[model samples]
Target: MEVHAIVDDLAEQLSKSGERWLHASAAKPKYFEFTPVELFAVTERMSLAEPTHELSADISHLVEFLHCVKNLKIRGARGYIGSSNVVWNALPFSLHLCKNILALWFTDCDVKMVSGLVNIRKTAKRIVVHYSMKNIEDLLLESSSIDDPNLLERWQRVEEVDFSFNDIDSIHPSIVLLKTMQRLNLSHNKIVNIGDQLQHLAFLTELDLSHNAIVHIDEWHTKLGNIKTLNLAGNKIANTHGLRRLFSLQTLDLSDNAISDIESASAVGKLPVLEKYDLRGNNVLNTIEYRTRVFEGFGERFTEIELDGRKADDREKDTVAVRLALQKAKKEREDLARLRKLQIDERIRFLSGEEHVARSV
Candidate 1:
C-alpha cells in the first residue's frame, strides 16, 4: 500500500476510535493515551467539527510527513507546536495556519527551514531557531534601516533570541530594532568583530558571543555597557583593553582564548562589580607567579573577584600578600639606590668644580 493510503487508513481508524471514546465516556471512568499520530488524526477531526477551536499539539511527525507530502493540511493548531529534532527542508505549510501559537520549538532543524515563518511573527513569544546554515539577515531583515516599519513590525516584541551554532560571520545591523530585546546568544558562529552592530540595544543585558573568530573587542564600553554577563570563551582574544568600562559586569567568561600576558589580562580586574571569571584556557595561566601578579594588578579588588572558578583560599591570599609586600620592598630599594646615585654624582661635580677653581686662582 502507498504511504497516503496507510496514513488515510490510520486516520480513519483513529478517528473511529476517538468517536467511540467520546460516545462511551459519560458513564464509565476510563483512561486513554494518544500517540502523536493518533493525536494528529483526532485533532484534525476535532478541528473539522469546530474550526474556531484552538489546540496545542506535538506535530513532529506531521511536519516530517508534510516534508514528504507537501499538500497535507493540519487544520486546527493554534497553540504550541513541538517540531524539535526533525530535519526540515522547509517549514511545513501547516505552520503558517497557526496564527496564535504560544511557543514554537524548531531546535536541531536547518536554518533554511525558518524562511517559512512569516505568518507567526507577532504571535510567537519564544522562537528557538538554531542549528547550522547561513545568511539570517535575509531571513529576518529585509531593510538596512532600524526605523524601517517592516523590520519593526517583524521583530519589535521579541525579548530573547538565540542564533547560536550557525555560520553567521557578522551580526545583522538591523538587530537593533528589537527595542524590547534583553538577551541574545550568537555563540558558536564565525563572528570576528562587533563594530557598532549592537550599540543601540539599551535594554540588552545578557550577551553570549563565545566560540567565534573574534580577536579584538573594539572598546565594548559604548557597545555593551548595559550587559551584565558576557561570555567570550574559545576565541582569539589577546587583550582586555576595552573591558574596563563595564561598570555593571558581574559574571565574565573568557576561558579558552588567546590572552597571553598578565598586563593584557589584568584589564578585566578593572571591571567594577565583577564577581566571577574564567580564564582557564588562556596562555596567561602559565605566566610566572600568574595568580600573584594578577592579584596585585587588580589592586584592592583581589579579595572581591573569583579566579578560574573559585574564590581565593587562605594559602593563595597569603601568597598574594607576601608577593605584594616583597614588591613594595623592591620598589623602595630601587628608589633609594637611584637617590644615592644622584647624590654621588652631585658630590663628584662639586669636587671637579673646586679643583678647576683652585688651578685658575
Candidate 2:
C-alpha cells in the first residue's frame, strides 16, 4: 500500500483511540526520516505526556506504524484550540506534550498563551517568537527562575531564539538565563540600552537588534568575538563608532537611522569584513557629493550600497544632479563634433578651389 494509505489507516486507528495526533502526514518524509536514535527520541518524548483514554487508543496505533515510518514531522497546527471560550488552564500538560519539539515558531500568537508553552523547556532546540509584547514581561519573569541547576541544564540546549517586532523596552533580567543560546534577534522593538544582562549569552553567533530605539551598541557586556551577523537598522543611533568592536561581523545592516552625514556612513564602511551595507532611508541624501565621497572612500571593500530609497526630496536632488551631468557631457560632445565637421568642410573647399584654378590655367 502507498504511504498515504498507510497513514490514513494509522490516523483512523488513532482517531478511534482519541489521542492527540501529530498529523505528520503534512510534513515531508526527508525531514522526518528516522535513525535508531531519532525513533527512540520520539518514543521517549511521547511517554512523558499523560495518556488519556482517547490519546491512548491513537498512540497505540501510531506506535505500531512508527516502526515503518523513517521520519515523523508535524505541521500546520494553527489555532488548534477552538473558541470554546473555556480556559482549560492546561499549561503544564501542554508543555509536557512539546518535550521533543526541535523547532517552534510562534508568530502573531497571544503572549499570554505562550507563557504556558515554556514549560517544555528541556526538549525544544529552537524557538522563534514574534509580534507578541503583551506577555513579554511575564515570559521573561518566568524564564528567569531557570537558574536552578536542574533547570539550567534544560535551558542550555536552546540554539536560537528570535523575539523581533515586540514592544520590549528593557532587556529582562531573565534573558540572562539562556547560556547556550547561539542566535538572538530582538529587532523592531523599543529597547534603548545594551545593558549588562546580555553578558550571560556567551555563545551568541547572530545578533539582530535592528529597528529599535537603541542609541548605542556599546553597553553590551558580552564580548561579541563570535558574532557573525549584526543588524542595527532603523534605530536612533547617529554614530557607527561603537560597532568597530565587533570583529567577527560579516553582514551589518544600519539602514533607516538618524545618520546626519557621510562621516557616520564612512565609519561603518571601514569595517574589516562587511560585505553588504544598507543605508537606505537615512539622512545621507542631504548631500550627494559627501555620499559619493564616502562610497569612494570605502573603495572595493563593499560590494553594494543601498542609496536609492531616500526620501522624495533627496531622490529629486539625485535625479537632477544626474540629469545635469548627462546634459553637460552631451553638449560638450556635440560642440566637439561640430568643430570637427567645420574643419573638414574648410579643407574640402580649399582642395576644390585649387582644382578649379589648375583647370582654368
User: What are the models' TM-scores?
Assistant: 0.64, 0.58
Q: Which model scores highest in TM-score? A: 1
**What is candidate 1's CA lDDT for residue 283?**
92
Worst 10 residues of 1 by lDDT: 69-78
**lDDT string, candidate 2, 17-74, tens digits:** 3222344433532333222222233334455564434443345465544433322332
lDDT of 2 at 182: 86
Runs in model 2 lying further than 4 Å from the true structure: 1-93, 107-119, 133-137, 140-151, 219-225, 299-361
Cα error of candidate 1 at position 222, Å: 2.6
Q: For residues 54-149, could you state the per-residue lDDT of candidate 1 as single tens digits?
A: 122223333333222211122222223455542223332224434444344443444332333454566545444455346556446532345453
RMSD of 2: 16.9
Residue 212 in candidate 1 has what lDDT?
92
Q: Which ten residues in a row have the lowest lDDT in candidate 2?
A: 86-95
